[model samples]
Target: MRIPRCYEPQPMNPGDSLMLGDNNVQHLARTLRMRAGDQVLLFNGDGQEFHATALEVDKRSMQVRIDSGEAPKRDSALQIHIGQSLSRGERMDYAVQKATELGMARMTPLFSERCEVKLNSERQDKRLRHWQQVAISACEQSLRCTVPQLDAPEPLDHWVRSVEADLKLVLHHHSATPLGDLPRPGSIALLIGPEGGLTEAEVQLAMASGFRPVALGPRVLRTETAPVVAQAILQSHWGDLAGN
Candidate 1:
């Protein structure tokens, strides 16, 4: 059976016995029904994977002994920081999840002119935590030792002006420029619009801030689907996805 992976946000050393967190404990003990002597993989977002054996397991808790740690070279060579416009319901969640699986280095939820999702401070914090957990879950499933950084939501204008990268791209269906024409970049900052799409002024503002408008194809893609397709194309072109 494939050993389940859990993310533990703490330093782990070989030979150290560690108590699993409540979330992980519940998942392993109740959900997975893992018992004593079952092996589990642990990662702390430190780009290292720890092999561990369950010493004790019950519905309430689980304790594991670390066997060893290995740092696998699984991270992508190209770094991508995406500025994704906030969408409603499962759309945003799907974008974050798929982006994490695609090896996005960082993601910042963006507020644009057409953005419809409204959240007060409390709801924003709640959503931030939820997205972080989503990224963690994706990491576990993708076997990514390092979890992608999910930044708190920020204005698109601010993100476009402040984000630094070797290359910056804003998805614009009207653009005649194709992605293949651009020079290869070690790092990229990508801007994606909301379901209603970015206003012409918003696109101009991003362009003035140094993001080049690039087209994926003739047909327009949904906000959530754009990031997945764009990142896959980018990764296949210049990142680790090509090798895989």
Candidate 2:
């Protein structure tokens, strides 16, 4: 059986004995029912993976010894930072999860004119933490060594003006430009609008801020689905998803 991979948010070195974090402990010990000597794979958001063996395990905790470490080339070569507008329900969660799997370098939740979701400071913190965990879980499932950075939710205009990248794109179905027509870029900043989509003024603001309006195809995609398709296309064109 493939060894379960766990995210241990601590320094990991070969021969180091480490106690798994509460989440991981619950997964390995309580959920998976792993016992002593069971093999596990671990990463700490570093660009490396460590092989480990369970030393002790119970319902509440699991301790493991690092057997070895390997630096795998799992991250995408092309960096894609997504400014995703917040959506209601599980849509935001789905976007964050898929973006992480697609090797997005960074993601910032955006608040646009048409955004339906509202959060105060406390709720914002709670959602940010939740989205971050979602990214980490995606990394584990996708076998990625690096967990993509999830930034706090910010206004659409602010992100469009402040984000840096070689190429910037705002998804607009009205645009005639295709992804294939764009020049290859080392890094890309992609903007996805909310359920109601970006208003004309908002699109103009992004365009004025250096984001080129690009269409995926004729059909308009959902707020959550746009990032998945956009990232896949960008990754396939210039990132690691091309050959693999």
Candidate 3:
């Protein structure tokens, strides 16, 4: 059987007997039905993975004996920060999850003019937590030791002016240039608009703030699909996806 990988929020040392709390109990106990002596992998988002064996398993609790730690940071050298406009429901969740898989260094949920999703402070907090969980799940599945940073939601105008990167790009289908014309950058700040797409004025504003307009192809993708496609293109061109 493929060993399961779980995220633990606590700091851990090799050889420690760790008792998992409410966070991981249900998943390991009921969901996976892991039994004592079953081996598993654990990570704490500390850029290391631990080889662990199930010490105890029950309905309420699961204990794991951590054996050793191995550092495996499956991160791209080209740091890419995705400024993604917030979409509704699964669309937003899909974007975050896929982008994490694509090796984005950070993600900033953007509130744009055309953004359809509306959230109060409480809803925003809840959504942020949900999004973090999505990223964590992605890391576990993708074998990425380090979880990507999830930034608090911010307005488009503020994020555009603040993000620093060697190349800054805003996706606009009507733009004159393809992505290949650009200089190779060690870091990129990529901006993707909402479902309705970025208004011409917003695109102009982003360009004024040092973002260059780029095109993906003739066919336009949905908001959720755009980030995953764009990140793949970028990674293929200059990031780790181009590996030997």
Candidate 4:
């Protein structure tokens, strides 16, 4: 059986016993129905995987004994930061989840002028937590040892001006440069618009802020689809998926 891996935030050392609480404990004890002696993999986003064995399982909590640590092979040479306009409903969630699986190091939800999804204070807080969980689940499913950092939602104007990356790209259907024309970099930043797409003015603003306008071939991809396709192509060309 494929053992389920859990992302634990606590510092772990070899031979240390750890106790899991909250939803994670409930899922392992009740949902997975895992019992004592079953092996589990644990990671703390420290770029290492912990080989652990279940010591106790109950409705209240689950405990595991850490055995040894093994440094995991790095996933990608490319460090990508995605600055995406916040779309409505599950569309944004899908984008965040897929980006995490594709090895984006950081994500910032951009609140653009054309963005239709507006969150009040309470809703924004709730949604941020939900998005964070989505990222965590993606890491578990993808077997990624490091979890991607999801930043607090910020306005597009402020975020675009502040993000520092070796290369910055704004997805535009009319832009001259295709992905191939750009210079390769160890780090890249991608700016994608919301459902209605970026307004012409916003596109101009992005261009003025040192973001190179680029196209993904001739096709116009949806807000959610663009990031996945772009990241896959980038990784295949310049990241871990390359040369294989």
Candidate 5:
């Protein structure tokens, strides 16, 4: 049977005892209904996971004892940073989750002229937390040792000017170049737009900022789907997924 992995904020080490809190405690006690001596894996976003056994279960917290275990090997070789235009509710969450699973080093939610969703400072903060959790859950599911970083959301124009990537791409249906045309770089950045897509002026702005326009295929993909496909293709081309 597969033991469930949990993300704990506290530090973990062999022979250490820790208590689960908040939703994590509730998840272990209620949802998983884990009994004493049940095996579970725990990680703290530190590129290592602890082999743990539940020691006690109560209303407030579930306690576990960590055991000596080898850390999981890192899977991604080429680092990818995704700059994605904000989409609606579940759409954005899906993209963030999949990007984490695909081994993105960092993520930034961008605001383009054609974007339909707009957020104030408060809403942006809440969304950033939500996206980080989505990424965490994805890492747990994929058994990734490292969690991807989620950067603060910024306007398309400003973010484009600030990034200095070894390879940068802005997805456009009318682009002449394909991602396959470029040699793999140590670090790559992919910029994808929302449903209505980026305006011509915005495309020109991206181009002027040193971002090459790359087309995925003949058909245009949905905002959420585009990043997943693009990341998978790039990974298979030069990252760990290659030759596998």
Candidate 6:
């Protein structure tokens, strides 16, 4: 059987028994009908994963005995922080999910002029939690023991100015620059626009803040597709995804 990988928040020690969270209990016990002695993999986002077997299972809760810990080395060497303009509905979720699987180190959703989504403080918090769960789910599927970072949504200009990286790039097809011309950077900050794309003024603002305009190719990609394509290129050339 495929051992299910799960995200647990509590600290883990080898050879210890602990209660899985309520959510996990529901999923494993009630939903999946998983019984005692089934094997599972658990990680707490502390850069290691614990192999465990269910020790007890019941309607309300479940316990697992931690067998051993394995540290995964799958993270990209190139630390990328995506300052992506917020798109509405599932588009934003899609971006976060794919970007995490692509090995993005950090992400900040940006409120740009072209962005259509609007949120009050309460809604923003809820959306943040939803997006975080999306990323966590991606990590479990991708076998990444270390979870990617996702920050609260902020204004585009503010994020552009504050985001730090060895190389900063903004994807604008009109620009003459290409991704291959730049020297290898240990870290990269990539800026991508929303559905309608970034305004000319907004692009200029990012350029003023040290983000150089670069294009993935001649064709213009959708708001949700740009970051994934850009990340693949960067990782292939300079990051951990590169292979012989």
Candidate 3 regions with alpha-carbon error over 4 angstroms: 242-244
Put down candidate 5 lDDT per residue, 6-75, tens digits, no spaces. 8888888899988886777788888888889999988888888889999999767898998865677765
lDDT per model, in order? 0.94, 0.92, 0.92, 0.89, 0.88, 0.91
- Per-residue lDDT over 186-230 for candidate 6, one digit per residue giving the tens place of the 0 to 100 score: 999999998898999999998999999997888999999999999
Clashing residue pairs in candidate 5 are none
Best by lDDT: 1
Please give the lDDT score at residue 84 for candidate 1. 97
- Candidate 6 residue spans exceeding 4 A from truth: none
Q: Model 6 lDDT vs. the true structure?
A: 0.91
Tell me the lDDT of model 4 at 194.
86
lDDT string, candidate 3, 1-244, tens digits: 8998888988888889989868688888889898999998999988899999899999999998989999975788889999999999999999999999999999999999999888889999999999999999999999988889998899999999999999999999988787667888999999999989999888999999999999888889999999999999999999888651
By summed lDDT, the worst window of 10 consecutive residues in model 6 runs over 235-244
Write the residue-wise lDDT of candidate 1 on 95-150 in tens digits: 99999999999999999999999989999999999999999999999999999999
In the range 143-235, model 4's lDDT, one tens digit per residue, is 898988898889998877888999999999998786667787899989999888999988888888999998888889999999999898888
lDDT of 2 by residue, 1-244 (tens): 7899978889999999988889998888988899899999999998999999999998888889999999999998898999999997699999999999999999999999999999999999999999999999999999999989989899999999999999999999999987767788989999999999999999999999999999989898998999999988888778888663
For candidate 1, the TM-score is 0.97
Cα TM-score per model: 0.97, 0.97, 0.95, 0.96, 0.95, 0.97
Estimate candidate 1's alpha-carbon lDDT, on a 0 to 1 scale: 0.94
> What does candidate 4 score on TM?
0.96
